[model samples]
Target: MNERQRARRPGGRSARVGAEVHQAVTDLISERGYGNFTVGEVAARAGVADSSIYRRWGSLANLLTDVALTRLNARSPMPDTGSLAGDLRTYAANVAREITGPDGLAVVRLAVALSSMGQQGVQARDDLLAERTRQLQSMLDRARERGEHAPDAFAVLDHIMAPMYIRVLLGIGPLTPEYVDGLVDRLL
Candidate 1:
């Protein structure tokens, strides 16, 4: 294989350290709330030196932003299941799984916290929303191209995404298969 054909990974030691730092930030946010933890605490929890985080992420807020973005956006590519219903069902279910994962609540909380954290925080929040919207739009656009009925992305966000996220965030209900399916069915 030629050089350009080789897969380049920034993982190895750097990725491990980054994951550790992200997890440390998530745990600190989960346990002590957003503004309550210091860089030293995170470094200790992540088993890396404080200077490591500072050098990599620059500050607590930057690290927190990275954690929130990485956790919240971690997912497989959106499903292209040949129909709107199939895609919606798959997408909604994936979201349900994510927001209900072990660190789901903490990640959600971190995202919410970041939204109120000032200019940089607001920008991070915007970037996340735009990316999610873009993903949803691609699915919807495919359905439309296939000559099927499809609602605008906002409708999906309002009717489906909002409820599941709210339920998870508020700890009000399980995002069971039935609940997730019902949301998709209602959208269809």
Candidate 2:
């Protein structure tokens, strides 16, 4: 197989059992919702000793964090559309498509449900939000550099792009090309 596949069963003393355990937990989460899950169950599912999981992740929350973020936090490389509207629409559609998928929906649901109690929760949410905002901001900055957008247009940028999440969460509309075209027309 490839290098990533090879890494699946790393050959050394420090090879991670965490990887296998996390995959098992991911499968279980797909089978069973996060709320109705347990560490013992994950251990059983992973076929690894419970201590191995605890040793790697320290707690269920940590394990779930790794499972959720590691799987869903892969941001694709941004495309250079040569114009603000084209780039933003492409980016938004790409992100919406990715995040609205089965795994992405699962991660969002899990994050919303659990990321609120402690330091880890706050950090996790902050990290996600910051990453998202940074992506949008980078696109906006690039657009400005190419003279496709106004230099001081953060407000307009937010106004146009903020609805992406609303569409996903409220299920108010499809993220269709026609819809993206409309958004581009209004914002750009």
| Per-residue lDDT of model 1, residues 1-188, tens digit only | 53322312375877788788878877777788887888899999999999877777656767787676665566735799999999999888888887788766664666677777778667766766687689889989999999999999999989998898889878887788998999889888
Error of 2 at 48 (Å): 4.5
Question: What clash count goes with each model?
Answer: 0, 0
lDDT of 2 by residue, 1-188 (tens): 65445444655632556666878877887787775677788999877777766666656776777666565445544567888767766766676677566654665677765564477556655665566557667777887777664433455446555566667777766778777677667765
Q: On a 0 to 100 scale, what is the lDDT of residue 126 in model 2? A: 63
Candidate 1 TM-score versus the reference: 0.73
Best candidate, lDDT: 1
Positional deviation of residue 106's Cα in model 1 after best superposition, in angstroms: 3.4
Candidate 2, pairs of clashing residues = none
Q: Mark the regions of model 2 whose C-alpha exceeds 4 Å error after superposition.
A: 1-19, 47-66, 73-77, 99-104, 144-162
lDDT of 1: 0.79
